[model samples]
Target chain A: MTNLLKNLATTEVLGINRRNQDYLRPLNSPSAKKIADSKLLTKRILRRSNIQTPELFKVIRTEKQLKYVDWSSLPKSFVIKPNQGSRGRGILIVYGKKKGSEQAWIQSNNQIVRIKDFESHIMQIFEGRFSLGSRRDIALIEERLKTDKLLKKYSYKGVPDIRIIVYNSIPLMAMTRLPTKESNGKANLHAGAICVGIDIGSGITINGIHLKSKSLLSDTYEPIEMTYDQKINLPIKGIEIPNWDEILEIAVKCQRESGLGYAGVDIAIDRDKGPMVFELNARPGLGIQVTNNAGLRFRLERVAGIKVKNTKHAVRIAKNLFGGSVSEEIELLSGRQIANLVEKITLFEKGKYKVKRKRKKLKQGTLLVKGLLDTGLLTSRIDRDTAAKLGFIDAIKSFNSYEIPKVFNSFEEAQAYIDKMDNTISKHEDIVRLAKITEEGKIRVRPVISVNLLIKGIHKNIEVIISTRKELIYPILIGRRELKDFLIDASKTFTR
Target chain B: MILPNLPHGIIVLLLFLPVIATIANFARYVLGIRTLGIYPALSLAFAFLLTGFRYGMIITTLVFAISSLSYSLIKYTRMHYVSKITVIYTANAIFLILAFTLFTQAPFFSNVLNLDFNEINPAGVLLIAVLIDFFVKQTVKKDWFTATRSFIETIIVSSIGFLIIRIPRFDLILVKYAWIIPLLIIVNVIIGQGSNLKLLEILRFKQIIVKPNPQDDKSS
Candidate 1:
C-alpha cells in the first residue's frame, strides 16, 4: 500500500474527483459548463467564429419531426447524436443504403436501420434515456467523416479522433482515440476503443492503452503497441497524425470561443475535408495520463498562470515548454516487446474432463517453467510431455496407440498415420487441430490443442502444437501469432 | 443529554446526517463503493433508522421487486418521463401500504410481537419510496448488473448508518457535543481535495504505476 501511494504521488496522476473540484469547478463558469454539456451549443458557438465543424443536417426535438421526417431525403452515410449525450451514448452511425431497400440503411455492424429503428432511437432521446442527468434532449444528424488515409490502416471500422486538453488557449496533452470493432465504432474508452498518447509537439503516437479483448480478463486494461487486430506490420507507434497543427489550432479556437477555462476538444480528420472539430468536453477523462505515462497535474501546474499572445503563440509556447522527449516516447512505446528468448508463460486448462454447459471453466494450470519465444516459427509448439502435464492427456493417449516407427519417417508417413485415425480421435475436446511437422530430419505428427496464455495479465487463447520435445530444454515454444508483443533486445534491464 | 426544546426526531436526524455523510465518503474514497450519488443513500439511511432493521429490509426488498416489475410494464408505454415514474411509484405505494395492512393484521405477527403500522412515520415511508426513481433510471439507461450493484451498495451504506444510530445513547453523545457537526465539513473538504489514488482507481490506472518486474534473464 505504501509503495502504491508513493508511486502514485511520484507519477502525480490526477483523479476524477480532483479534476472536477480543483481544475474544472474553480476554473470553468457554470455557463461555460452549460455550453459544453450541449454539443449543438458548442458547435454553434464555434461555427459562428468560422471554425470548421461537421455540418449539421437536421435536429429532432419532438415526435412530430421524428415521425414525419423523410428517411430517403437523408444522406447515404451520416451519424446520429444525442445533443447532450455523454461518453458517446445515444449515438448511431448509418453506413450506407442497403441493397434494394428504399428506406433502409446499413449500420457499422451491418444491422439494418429502417424508419421504425430511427423512430425508436429518437424516442429514447426524447425520453432522456441517454441525456445528461436524464433531461430531455434534442437529436441531430451530422455528416459522418471517413477515416483519413494515414489513420485508416490503424483503425478497424471508423474514424480515429484526437482528444486535446487545452488550458488558457494552449494545448497541454493529447491522445488519439481509435474505434475498434469491439467498441461498436464509437471510440469510447469505456466501450473498448484504443487510446494512444500523442506528443504535443511532434504528434507522433506513443503506446496505446486498451481493454484486453478476452472475456476471462473482462475488466482488465493493458498497454499495447499494436493495432486492434494485433497486426505486426501495422504498428500503432510512430505514425504521424495528419493535420497536427490545424487540429491544435481548432482545439484552441474551440476552447476560447466556448468560454471554457480548461477544456477537452475532440477533432477527427476527414479523408477529404481534413481536420474538423467533433465536440467539446468540459471535464474530460484522466485516462490520457495513463496513455502518456505522465502526470497531468504537473503539466497543468507548470503553465497554469503563463500568458499567451495568440493561438499560434500558445501552440509555440506549448511545443517549447511542455513537450516530452520524442525519442524516449518512441522507445517507451516499443518496450511492450517481451524481449526474452525464454520467458515464463501461464496456461489455463479445463477444470473438469468435460466442461458442462455454462459451467465454471478454466482452472488456471501450473505456469510453464520456461517457454521459448521462437520468432522463426509461424505456429506455437508445445512438447508432448509438457502438454500432457498441462492436462492434455487425452491427446497423448490417442497418440500413444499409434505404433512407433524405428526408421526415420517421411512427411507422407506422418500424414498417413494421422489419416488412419477414426472419427472419435478428432472429437477430443482439448484437440483443436492436427499438424504435420518436419523436425530432427524426420516427420512428426502433433495435435494442436487450444490453450489460454496469460502474460503480464493479458489473456489470449492460442493454439499450441503438441510435439514430442522430451530432449529439448524448453517445454513450450510460442510462435509469431503474438510475436509482435515481444521484441528482441540486448539487455533485459531497460529502465525507463 | 437530551435537549428539552428540540423534538427528538430533528435532533436525531441532525446527528445521523453527519455520520451518514462520513460513511458515504469513506465508502466512496477508501472502499471504492459507488451508490446512486448521495441523496438517495442519505434519505434511505434515515428511513432505515426510523423503521428499524428487519422492517427496513422487508420494505426495501419489496420496493426493489415491485418497482422493477412496474418499470418493465410502463417503459414501452406512450407516456412522458414524469408520468411514467408517477405510475411506477403509485403502483409501489399501493403495494407497500397493502403489505403493511396485511402485516398488522396477520395472526403470526402477534406471536412474534406485533408491529404497529401507525408507529412507522409517513415521512420515512416516503423517503424509502424515493429509491424507486433511481431504480427506474438505472434500468432505463444501464444494465441490471450495474443497477443491482449500486442498489446493494446503497443498502449496505444505509445499513451502516442505521446501525450507528442504533448504538445506545448515540444521539445523546452528539447532543452533548455540538461542534462535531461543523467539524464534519472539514472532513468533507479533505475528501474532496484528496490527492491519493482511490482504492478502485489504483487498479484502474495500474498501467501508469511502473512495476519493477525483476526479470530473471538467464537463457541457455
Candidate 2:
C-alpha cells in the first residue's frame, strides 16, 4: 500500500493532476478549446495550414439532412462521429454496405447497421446525445483510414491512431491506442483497450498498460498485466511507426494554427496516404502519462515559455532535450555526451613563470581560456608562440619533431606565407602532409601536444595542434573530438 | 422617511456584502476563478452581520480553532475521511455549546461582550456551525497547514467586509439609492473579463515578460 502511494507521488503519476490544474486550464483558452473539441473547426483550421485530415464525406446538421442523405453514394468504408463526441463515443465505423442489402452496413465490431440505424444515430447526434454536456451537435461522415500493415497486428479490429500531447508548440509525449476484444473492438482504454507508450525521439513503442477491470472494488483495483489474449502474449513494444516525422510535424502545426497553448493531436497513418491528423483536443486526458510510463508535467514545464521559431525547431528541441531513450543511445554510441557549440575551458600556464617547454612532464598549471569549440577541425589548436610560452614546445616537438613555425600576427603576413607555401609544400606529398590549411588559407606544420583541462570542475586530457594566433582572436581552440564530457554553450563566454 | 427608526441605511449596507458575494460566487462558477482563500468570505460576512462582530468573531474563531485542532489530531487515527470530518464537527459542536455558556456568564467586563444565550438565534448558530464544518472539511482535504491558513484567511476577509459595511457614508449611499446595488453585477462582469491571468500566474510568468538582453537566444 505504501509502495503504491509512493509511486503515485512520483512525477509520472501526479503529472496528470498537476498538468490539468496548471498547463491545460491556464494555457488553453476557452475559445481555443472550441476550435479543438469541434471536429469541423479542427479540420478547417488544420486544412488551412496544409495539414491533412481525413476527407469529410458529408455533414448532417439537421434531422432533415439525415433523412435526405443518399446512403448508397457514401463510401464503402466511412466513419460516423458526433462533432462533440469524446472517448470514442458516438463513433460508428461502417466497414462496408452489407452484401446485397443497399442500406445495410457492417461495423468494425461486426454489428450490422441498416440505414434506419444510421438515421437514428444521426438524430441522436443532432439532439446532442453524445455532444459535450449533451448539447445539440452535428454529425460528420469521414473517410475511414485504412490501418497501416505494421499497426494491424496490435489492434483487434479498429484502426489505432497516435495521440500526441503538445504543449507550448512542443510535442511532449506520444502513445498509440490499440483495440482489444475486451473493449469490443474499440481502441478506448477505459473500454479495456491497450495503450502503448511511444518514445518521442525514436518513434518506437516502449511499454504497454491496460485499464484495469472496473468491476473490481477500489481497494482491489490495479491495472492488469498486459496479455495478447487469454493465452498468448502480444508484442506491444518496439513497433516502429512509419512517417513519424510527418506525424510530429502535423501535430505541432495543429497546435500552432489552433492557437492553443496546449493540445492533444490525434494522427493516423493511412495505408497509402501516409499520416493524416484526425482530431485535436484542448483538454486531452492525462491517461497518456500512464501509457507513456513517463510524466508529462516535467516535459511540458521544461519547454514552456521558450520561444520556438517553427515546427522543426520545436521538434528538434523536444527530441534533443526530452527525447528519452534515443538520447541515451546517442550517448552510448559516441562514448561521449553531447554538449553545446561553445564551452568554457581553463588554460594552464607556468608554476609562477616559465618559458617552459618540455617533451614530457607532470605539471599543474593555470590559465583559464574561453575556447570556441568547433567540430569541423580534426584536432584542437592553439597559437604557436602562446603554446611555446605555455611550455607545450617539448611535447609538440616530441610528437612530430617539427620546428616552430614563424608567427604571423596579421592577415597580410599569413597570406604571404600561403603564397610561398603554394610553391613548395603544395607539390610535395610529405610537405603537404606536414602542412594543413588554416581558416585564413595559410598552411603550417604545427606540432601536437596533449594537455589537461578543467572545465566546470571536470578534468579532461585533450591534444591540441599548434598554430599561429595572428589571425584568430581566441588563443585556445577546442575541437569536437576533444569535447567529451563538457557541454558547450556558445552564448556563454569564459567564466573564471 | 417611511421607516425612520429602522436605520434603513445600515440595513441596506448590511445587505451589500452578501449581494456582492453572490455575484462573486456566480463569477467563480462560470469563469473558473481559482484564487485561494476567497470563496466563503461572503458567508462569513453574512454570519458577522446577523450577529454583532464580537459574537460573530467568537463563533467563527471557536469553530475553526476547535475543528482544525481536532482535524489535525484525528488524521493520524486511521479513520475514513467521512468519519474523520464527523469527529471534527462533533468536537466543534461540543466546544461551541460550552464556550457559549462560559461567555454569557464570565464577567470580564459585560459591556465588551454582547453575547446572550437567550437572544442568540439557534438557526444562525446552526448556519455558522455548518459553514465552519464545511470550511474545515474542504480546506483539510488539501493539507493541514492549508486548512489552518484558510481558516484564518476566511475570518480575515469577512472581518474586512464587515468593517467596510460599517462605514457611515457608504451605508447612507446604499440606503438612499438601493437601485445602485445592481451596478455591482456590471462591475463583477468587467472584473472577470478584464484579467485572464490570475494573481499567482502573473508572478509565475513574470520572467517571460521581463526578458533579459536579447543577445543569447540559443542558450537555456
The TM-scores, one per candidate, come to 0.67, 0.54
Q: What is the iRMS for every candidate structure?
A: 8.8, 16.7
lDDT of 2 by residue, A1-496 (tens): 3443333333223233355667677889888999988999989988898889999999989877878999889889999999988778779899998898887899977889888778777876776656676578899999998888888766777778899989888898898888888877777776777888777866888667775443211111133345466244557766788888778888889998998888889988888888998888888876676555455555665677889999898887776555545434455666655444555566665333332345334345666556677767767887766676667655444534423355555556656655655454333321221334464554444444556675554566666766755777677777767666654445323232
Error of 1 at A14 (Å): 1.4
Locate the minimum summed-lDDT window of 10 residues in model 1 chain B: B211-220
Give the interface RMSD of candidate 1. Answer: 8.8
lDDT of 1 by residue, A1-496 (tens): 6676667656556676667777898888989999999988988888898888888899888988787787778889999989999878788899899999888899888999887887878887887878888898899998988889888887868788999999878898899988877777768776778899887766888767886642211246688877756233377778888878888888888999999999999999998889888888998888887777766766777777888889888877676555534544444778754345666666656443332325434443545456777877889888776777777897779656656453336777766766775344567767766677766656766678887666544566788888775576777788988777666432322211
Can you list the residue pairs that collide in candidate 1?
A338-A486
Please name the candidate that would achieve the greatest TM-score relative to the true structure. Answer: 1
Misplaced by over 4 Å in model 1 are A8-11, A64-68, A212-220, A228-234, A329-496, B1-6, B29-32, B54-126, B139-146, B189-199, B206-220
Computed on C-alphas against the true complex, the DockQ of each candidate is: 0.14, 0.02
